[model samples]
Target chain A: MTALSAAAERLRIRSGAYAGQTAGLARGHVQANLAILPADWAGDFLRFCQANPKPCPLLAVSEVGDPALPTLGTGIDIRTDVPRYRVYRDGVLTEEPTDIRDLWQGDFVSFLIGCSFSFEEALLADGVPVRHIAMNRNVPMYETNIDCVPAGRFAGKMVVSMRPMAPRDAIRAIQITSRFPSVHGAPVHFGDPAAIGIRDITKPEHGEAVPVEPGEVPVFWACGVTPQVAIRTARPPIAITHSPGTMLITDLLNTHLSVL
Target chain B: MTALSAAAERLRIRSGAYAGQTAGLARGHVQANLAILPADWAGDFLRFCQANPKPCPLLAVSEVGDPALPTLGTGIDIRTDVPRYRVYRDGVLTEEPTDIRDLWQGDFVSFLIGCSFSFEEALLADGVPVRHIAMNRNVPMYETNIDCVPAGRFAGKMVVSMRPMAPRDAIRAIQITSRFPSVHGAPVHFGDPAAIGIRDITKPEHGEAVPVEPGEVPVFWACGVTPQVAIRTARPPIAITHSPGTMLITDLLNTHLSVL
Candidate 1:
């Protein structure tokens, strides 16, 4: 089947025609994590994302009470563009919905944070092995001992995704991912898992565990779920985030995000 | 004493005022390996360097019988600019000479291959500890199982210089060295010595072995001595090279080598 363009995919999402995972739907486009917060919490959240750029790289933020993220796409409405959404009340998951228009408030502020999909695409294109993709499983993720710099109420440990690769391939992956800083950039930790407080390599805090070959090392990059953890720590009265694996597809070309 | 200018250092070498090692003599200037071969052997040698760029990164090759490498400096005299010279006959060292004026042949072709000193200086400036410099010893160099692409009779195992670094520091070093491709860009092997066919980590084929801390990993880069090894294997009738640690200082700024 011919894959839809990023605009078409977002339109399908907006019209409630498609609600599947956005991973391979629109290739060469930027996919982002959705975070809609009350205006009172946005100031601190912006500070939080700025403080912890690796996990919460801010791509675009909506103006107070505004839903249009024009910089990200031609006609993106945050309330309906995402394939799925999760509403949080007092840091607890209260509801899951395909569209958040009924729940939107006049003081709501939406943020589009970078996703690993861009760098993963780059790594695959460069012939580097992405093990989880081959296994048809979600990338393994773990909560690391490394702490994010706290801003106001936002404070928590970093969450990282792991990909098993030979040391040579790991080196190439570092170089490729370093180009896309918006998507976590170079790995924070590699070689030793225990060094980052990950006690068991087989069991992960989130996502599926892929086998690490005899000669391969588990390379780790900060995961986007980090902000969600921070939001839980902040314990905001009302907060919303995209459901796992379903992101807001955007028209921003992945190529254009390259800092180089 | 303040470091001398590259031109002044070359002038001192030319006038017999200085006959010391070139390292740390002219900060921020490029120092190169000297290889002199008769014109008939030049074509094959050039092809060899082209095919095996990692070890034999050809910086400047002088025209037939031409003593000047104008691109590298104001007036680089291949015969007198270097501090010391090693003369070889039938692949065996015949003499160590302070000056090679009498040995200079009109048909001789001179190649100024890149030296590691440029990237080492860069690493040091970026606060990356260089163990060899701190320990006051030559960097450990090993003969690796990795083979260079042969051109004519020029062929041998690649020789690599090793530096011990923490994983994160090694990552930074990789990024820094990658900028200077002419200076044997980035590491060839890292972590395990056995993986690259080195039997003993403490004993190197050439240079001195500094201590590798328990948490540190040995990183290896293609060494300039690799071409000399290839020349020895080829067994040309006559060849001349700069003595170990003594190099031809050039006016080019190390900063200019950064591709970024």
Candidate 2:
């Protein structure tokens, strides 16, 4: 889009002019992990997000059967704003679509969960290097032994995203990321891979692993993938999520997400 | 004193009835690192402390030739309130005294500095175990390679206090301590000691080393001793400080120091 405004970017996505990861796009504005479920499952899913905020920090919830998330952005249409979407049937990936306009159900409820991209922008601005961004790879993520508090049928172990940093930078990362509790807050763990039940540091469960340097430590933050793990366990009849790295553009500024 | 009120404790020290470490005595109050210098050096020292806040966060400063630090508490006598004192003459330790009343000078200026004891209380309240407290030893202190911004005559590498914690606790400690910027907020360095120019983790320049467990990483905070190092290097003709572990307790609640 010429303007590159969040709404402009969304309009481009809606028109099928762009269908790619939203990580670095729409810089300074908030990018959200999209989750859509039928009206019947919305309450329990909302509860899951609230109960496990480190993994699923809720930013906005749309009115039942309405796509507009007025609180997050203007004239937003969840079914078409995100560049890419993963539609699951009975918790199994059934289709990948650029726009979900045709698939949208009148009873669908949309949830906008906080994304790490917001805080990654904050970290980069503070001169902290994000390894995945520097490497041009998806942040390596692993399923952790830490369990999420159950809400109805939505419950599972946590999944965490990894970033390798020198101890000094990691300390700085902790301080900077803590300002945005909505975007995973401070790191959950660091150092030993096996301590958090990851069998191998190089073999992450999701995304590619970048080398943690000789003196660098691996810092882990709770990942939005955690909700996907819970959804897999719950085995809902229909579930829709933004494909990994593909996020919904919103009007909220990254700085606005900072709780402090 | 049978009562643990900060005022009562300060009264005992003022009366020369107590002359011991202030740790755990005034559990909920803010404790300060005491520094006294000739009036001529006070402005430079204040500037040094302001420039290197992480190492020398200034909480309160008494007017020149004044023994009263009324801002810190009711009638805080800099010359006598601390349990024990170290008097240095031309950079050399000349006396260790319980009361400095006889030595008080009309041209002396008193500086009250933020102490780690305040954040340690915050950490313990958050259910984080402090190893030095558990082991009944002093927290290990190390000299770092990171240089302080030189101000007038005061300049030196920062001295750091080490507390070994599992990654989780260290992260939580960073978040909790960050709220108290006046008390050397967050850690300056963590993980490898060598990275910060600390040659040996087991050997510390000041204080006793406690055991660091297998999964634990040594977390380092900028120490109050940093100013002591600078002061020693500056070699002012007449200087005084509270002996290590002996502090000036104040009426401010530790909770009030938290920014959030």
Candidate 3:
């Protein structure tokens, strides 16, 4: 069969035909981390995201009970467009499903959080090496002791993703990433794992740990998973999120996110 | 006596009346690191600075054997405008003189390099705390294992100046400094000393080590001294440089260096 268009790709996802990871699908478009919370809890969560923008940069927010996110793409139905979703009950993971049509609720508010895929593409295009991508593994993530700016009902330490590069490449990565503030701009910490509260550089809190070669430094960027950590801490009555690595692809170009 | 205008300040230095450190002298203008060499070595040195722009960002170059630098300021004489000068014989420090008039050679070539003071002012204006500035000490610097891109007769490990700050502030600092790439730009390394081959965090090779708080991370920027280290390794027959902290004040505003 011919490759599906972006809209058709979402349609196939909604129909349970393509339920795999969305990492390289819908090339050149923006991909987002999905978060669906009850309207009663969303105000505080929005404040939380606004306060800690680097980790929870909000790209688009749906109205109360609305499933369609018009700002992100045409006919983008948040309830079913993503390839996979995880349902939470009182901040506990309850189900992982290919679609959320049966689980959709009128009180739900959907938020599209910026993902690092955009910035990674920019880095690669700029000739900067992305070790995790080259090694075919998920970016290594660590929990930092650094606290996020607190909002009512949302508070937790920050989480960061790591990639190893030479000092000069790391510097260039910083400059390139700073232009995309919505995608966890720049890096939170670099060089030392212990400096940010990670005791073991060889082990990571989440994802696979990649090797940092000799003469290379480990560069860390604030990860989008940070908000999920905060949400778990908040312990809301109900919440839903995209399954790991299954993001909501939108029509927006990654370049559109750059402030410059 | 009335306060010396910037031009008057330069004139005073030129006349050998003001020979102290140039810090805080030309409040709103740019100050540059000066390097003078024989015409035979000028091409290679210029290529070196161009190849490794971070530590040796060239601001202006004087005509061969000309004492005056027109682009930097009015009636600015490179041989006498700087408050202090270091004369080197065979790449060894011989004398720290107030002026180079008596030792001036017809084959001399002068280069002005961008200094960190420009970006420090930008940071301070943005409310970012500079630890060294706050403590009234020089920025702590370390020679790293990371090497610069080699140019003819110019190859050495990069040298970096350090400042300790909380992780969050460091992120903001990266963004602010990235705007001014002409001046060292963003940090080279942060977090761990061992990652970059430094054995001890508290003991720096140059400048006094400052305090690193419990939650703060040490941020490192490429230092202008990298070129000096490379020059020392090259071991030229004769070289001249502005004494540390005694730069050639220019007419350019710090904001004029911003790439964005």
Candidate 4:
């Protein structure tokens, strides 16, 4: 097991002592996708998550104007605990900061979303091969013609992460991943990219494309990046999020996320 | 909404009052895939199902030599409850009989396997369109190159039932089906059949092929027919099964099978 205390790891991140991606850090804890918005946009975004659960699976919502996320982890100061934060103004990224203390607003609300990292760990534990991880690359992600259930202005086509596995492994992966409903659950699609309006399989919208072998089929899961894409399209006056790959490590055990 | 009384329906089946398929009979009640074997081959088949859950999800096992399946329904006699039964001798079907009372042996062991009907109801309830159901045909099934976990003399490639759906509905279907693991949990594959060694999309080894529309991908689920194929390969001296499309209607509610 990876030997790292989740709380101590958060402290390091908060102190600006750690600024790298949180992918392999705090191993067993539930790492969340962070999305901070002004109190004005919080209600609509929350409803959006409720409507499109597979993509924007909401785990926790911070109290309005609160900086500390008590439910996710102890000593988690949302403003400083994330290794990297992206600040957006009118939907355009204006700054990338290691800490957000100077920009903390009294009317801001933070939303923690379920991330795929936890489910990937479950798959690996079950001896399923994660192609991208083995090749040391980010998972291949595609923007699909599949539309998310709309809620007010928060609307956009769904984005999905793809992994290729043999038929047998794909079946087992479906069963295993189904246990973690909060983390995108089972795959959204598998096989032909064109079937989902993905014109180019090798050319993904975000992340690097991994090799899909002769007998392997590409399995796509509803991605957390979907909410980010939607947020960008909605053009919120101000928004904050952890830079891609930088996540908030929570105290909740990954196993605790399994419904069954 | 199907208006058929359980006992009256069984009486109809036994008296040749109903000659049609039992697909939607006794809605809300559990319908079982029947597999009757002589005492000698029963143990091995039991072990096979325990080893390979996806293709052979066993819902009930009867006492050796007993034709009565009490757990499934009240006063249910396996030999007469089903509309029709196929009698196999030395692994080949020798007769299709309406009643197996005369053939019932004291050494026979009956196994009730979970059928996709349970989960299909779930998917439809959740607003996922099932192509075959909409088209009024049997689900398209294919023999995949994927092998089932072998046990004793029971071993063969898995059989899968296919449905065509858009990516969004496919994801919802996965979540709905996952709750009924006993009825083949989630899909084994979706998209290209060639990846699973199914060369032709228009032709299937069993069941009718439904049209896959431009934007819809073919989703394949582990089929109950898989065990029947395995059992045939074993060539047991004496075996009996409900005729294809003619299932044993039981009192067990479909909701009772949901794991989540």
Best by TM-score: 1
TM-score of each: 0.95, 0.94, 0.86, 0.87
Chain B TM-score, candidates in order? 0.97, 0.97, 0.95, 0.96
lDDT tens digits by residue: candidate 1, A1-260: 12258888888889999887888878899999988899999999999999999999999999999989989887788999898999999998899899999998999999889999999999999999899999889889999899999999989999999998887888788888888999888888777788889999999998899999886778899999999999889999999999989998888888888998
Q: Least accurate stretch of 10 residues (summed lDDT) in model 4 chain A?
A: A1-10
Least accurate 10 contiguous residues by lDDT in model 3 chain A = A1-10
| Descending-TM-score candidate ranking | 1, 2, 4, 3
**Stretches of candidate 4 above 4 Å error?**
A1-4, A40-52, A63-65, A144-157, A195-197, A226-238, B1-4, B146-155
- Residues A176-238, model 4: lDDT tens digits: 888899998988777778878899989999889998998787889999988888889889999
Tens digits of per-residue lDDT for model 1, B1-260:
22258888889899998887888987889889989999999999999999989899999999999999999988778889888899888888889899999998999999989999999999999999999999888888999898899998788999999999988888888888888899999888787788888999899988888899977788899999998888888889999999989999999888788787
Cα lDDT of model 4 by residue, B33-150, tens digit: 9899888888889999998888889989999888777777667788887888888887798999988999989999999999999898888788889889999998888999998888
Which structure among the candidates has the greatest DockQ? Answer: 2
Q: Which stretches of candidate 1 lie over 4 Å from their true place?
A: A1-4, B1-4
Residues A162-240 of candidate 3: C-alpha lDDT, one tens digit per residue: 9998866877888899989998888877776788788887889888999999877788898998888988999998899
Candidate that would win on lDDT = 2
Per-residue lDDT over B91-203 for candidate 3, one digit per residue giving the tens place of the 0 to 100 score? 78899999888999999999999888989988889888999899988888899998888888878998888988876677778888888888888887777787887888788
DockQ, 0 to 1 scale, candidate 3: 0.40
Please state the Cα-based DockQ of model 4 relative to the true two-chain complex: 0.43
DockQ of each: 0.51, 0.82, 0.40, 0.43
